[model samples]
Target chain A: MEPIMAIVVGLLYAAAIYMMLRRSIVKLVIGLMLLSNAANLLIFTSAGMSRGAPPLIPLGSALPDGPVADPLPQALILTAIVIAFGVLAFAVVLIHRAYNIIRTDNLDQMKDTDT
Target chain B: MSLEVALPVIIPLLTGTFCVMLWRHNVIQRVLSLVGSIALLASSIWLMVSVLREGHVVMYMGNWVAPYGITLVGDMLSAIMVVLTGMMAVAIAIFSLSSASKSHERFGYYPLMHLLLAGVAGSFLTGDIFNLFVWFEVMLIASFALLILGGERAQMEGAVKYVTLNLLSSAIFLSAIGLLYGITGTLNFADISVKLAAAEHTGMVDVIAVMFMISFGIKAAAFPLFFWLPASYHTGPVAVSALFAGLLTKVGVYALFRVFTLIFNQNPDFTHELLLWVAVGTMLTGVLGAAAQFEFRRILSFHIVSQIGYMILGLALFTPLAIIGGVFYIMHHIIVKTNLFLISGITHRLLGTYDLKRLGGMYKARPFLSILFLIPALSLAGIPPLSGFFAKFIIIKAGIEVEAWFVTFVALLVGLLTLYSMIKIWAEVFWKKLPEGIDPTPLKEGKTSGSLAVLYLPVVLLAACTLVIGLHGQPIYEWAEFSASQLLNPEGYIDAVLGGNRP
Candidate 1:
């Protein structure tokens, strides 16, 4: 199961990188989103996988510390997700404005104006 | 533990939020920002003196232990940067009061500026990597808003490139943090330092170092990643451009100095060589770019990239004296560069344009403004008995001592070219006769009073600071040496962060 999860993340990362190499502005935005998600998953999986049960113990039950999924990575990933979401939203609006003014979404066409 | 140490960050944050609430009352908002900036400047001075006497001061949040929680560490380097930010903030606030139009003021420009200051100060003072990331976001968001506040077509275009490149850098930064955490299982810088010192994974360490370098290199406008800077920085208002010039790239250089000296000093040979090559490339490219420009602000924008190369050159030399030179260079560049940009603002208002072909004979018109421009321009070109000369001398001496003669020669050449560019502006804009069909009478009549005078005040103050720092170089040199020693000897930082002698 751990190896399978790693393979899945590897594939996602490759796809994200490929998409990031595209020319269109919107696809590049989606590429960044995908890349961020892959990073989050990579961080999550590196802390080790869970097998037995959820880490939360019942109210009066004896706490078992043997093998639980690490909670810290999940918390970090959640924070990163929110922050990346905010950045992506801003990027969307910025790109929209750029397109409206420059009248194109191609990255190469937006050459340095001074030249 | 003193409140003075924290006020540099706190005052800006509080005032920013308060201004948001009082946005309708323009007078109240402006007063709040003015008082806040003044108080920040005072506190930064106090904090600098205290840190100079007491050494490094660490404040752990909520009474938590340093390793387990976040910490704000105030040393000579951070304290000096805070003071610089405070001073720049106050100057920009004063300039904006008279220069900013009603529409811009209505859009909460002052509040955003304060928030930007708060974020810059926080980034300088933070002792944890994650906390630094948070501050980067704060600064970026405020800068984003400030860039687009006018909603002009050119501004929106520039902001797009700025935001995109910065977002990509942030993503890379987060990935580096994740990698570091995955290996060491800790996010605290001091804790990670100790762990990394004990670890034996050389290959992994180099990979992580490169990741950190690339992320920071983009922010510092290093070679290969500096295209976004000249594209975007010229589009902002004069005050915003001035503040950005003074504060933003220095934050990246400061971070590079902190992390390399503290956490990644084990393998200096490889890292220093790579950084040296990058520095040389950055300098040559930046100066040539500056030489190609004809506009006032665009040339200055490219020079920011070139000057950053000098700072990185000092860092890449990896000697104690060299790092101290880097610190001095940072201080000198911040004040002089900001003053030069603000003077450009004055020129724009008086001459009605920034193009060299269109502007001429300003010396006969506004003697005071020409004097203001001359001092900083000469200082930037490394004239003797000025701050820029001393900074270049120290770094060049360090480079030669290390037997990097080729790089030393290249650096000197860059300095000469920089002087040529400066003189081009002087000859074209100030010395030559006025261009045809230009109404010289309006500038002559309107130069001495109103909004223009207010803008000149900040430039004058900054120019005075450049001269003073140049004249009194001994004390600043000593402070920079002490700061560099603190960085080179990472034991103190590690002990303070991990609660003393963890081994």
Candidate 2:
């Protein structure tokens, strides 16, 4: 199960890197979108596969007695996804605005600030 | 007891929120921002005093104990960083009052600035690695909006690069954090230190270590990774540039120093060696880049990268004195660089240009401004009796003592090059005759004198700070030395974060 998840993550990353190399700013953004999901999947795969119950304790118990899945990675992934969402949403708007102003979608055309 | 640890983060958060609430009242919003900045400064100083007098200040969230709960810890280094942030907050707040355009003031600049400050304060104080990532995002998003706020073509273009590179760094950083958590099963810095020290270090640990370094290196604007900085920094308003100049990359440097000294110490043979080469490359490349630029802010932006090299040099040397010099360099550089940016803002406001070729006659026309510029400019070049002199002196002295002759030589050579660039600005901007057809009229030339006064106010205050740090550098150096010791020896930090209660 872990190996399959790993392979899937690797494929996503390869696709992301490919999309990133394109000249179109729009595809560049798609690359970024793919990149972030690849990272999120990597986190999920690396945290190790476990068929454990939900992490909850009995009403009066101080701690759970059974094997439970690690909750931390889930929390970490949730935070990472939300942050990526906000940032990517921002990236989409920014590229759109840049397109509107510069009249081009090519990253090569966006080199005015380089000088 | 832990409230002291929380105040620096809270004041800025609350202030930013309230500033948003008073969205329609610009005047009231300005006042709130100013008060919040002062409160942050006061609280940061308070935290440092306590940390210096007592030991580390730790506060676990929601009554949870160490290693299991989120924690905020204030050691000497964090305390100093918070103080610097506080100082910059106040300086920027006062400067922004008059510097911001009406539209800029109306559309969320103050809130974003405070939010940025909050993120900086939180990053310095958080005991958890994941919390650091969260804080980085908070800072990044705010900076992203600020960079493109005006929607100018130059700004939007620059924002495309800045936003894309920073988001990539965040992605890399998040992935690194995930891998680290997978291995250590804990996010707390001190806990990981203890765990890794006890367990046999495998090759995977070194892999994770390099990953963290690369992500942080990008943020710190280290060599080969600093292209985004000069491209975008000059596009923003001067105050925003000054803020980034002072705090943003320093946060990255701070992370490097912290992780290397604590969690990554076990593999110094592999890691520190890499950092040494990185530092030298960063210094040489940055100064070379600056030497080529003629624009006022672009030159300064490149200098920011070069100065970071000195701080990293100190850290990489791995001596107590070197760490002291590194710590002192960080403190002194923040004030000096921010002040230089503020001074640039004034030069722009007065003479109506930032291109050095068109800038001139400030010596004859505005001797006072020339003097203000001299203090930071020369100090930045490591002149004696100014802050940069002492910073460079200590770092070089430590390098010599360690017998690292080549690095020591590079350090000295960079100093000379730095002086050359600073002198170039002085010669071009101040000494040369005002070029033909440049506007003699200041912006809003007929505007109230009081607004003009506000512009000079932060500049003067920061210049005076440079003077004080230079003339009376003993206590400050000692403070840096003490912090350096704490960094090298983290027993107290580990105990406080993982076991011992706060004072």
Best by DockQ: 2
lDDT of 2 by residue, A1-115 (tens): 9889889988988998888889999898998998899889888878866875788898999999878888878888998999999999999999999999888898898888785
| CAPRI class assigned to model 2 | medium
| Candidate 1 displacement at residue B150 in angstroms | 1.6
Could you list the chain B TM-scores for each candidate? Answer: 0.98, 0.98
lDDT of 1 at B97: 80
| lDDT for residue B279 in candidate 2, whole number 0-100 | 93
True interface contacts reproduced, per candidate = 0.29, 0.65
Model 1, docking class: acceptable
- The weakest ten consecutive residues by lDDT in model 1 chain B span B494-503
lDDT per residue as tens, model 1, B231-338: 888888878888888899899889899888888888988877888998999999999999999999889999999999999999999998899989999999999999
Would you list the C-alpha lDDT of every candidate in the order shown? 0.85, 0.90
What DockQ results for candidate 1? 0.47
List DockQ for all candidates. 0.47, 0.78
Give candidate 2 misplaced runs (Cα > 4 Å): B443-448, B500-503
Identify the candidate with maximal TM-score: 2
Which candidate tops lDDT? 2
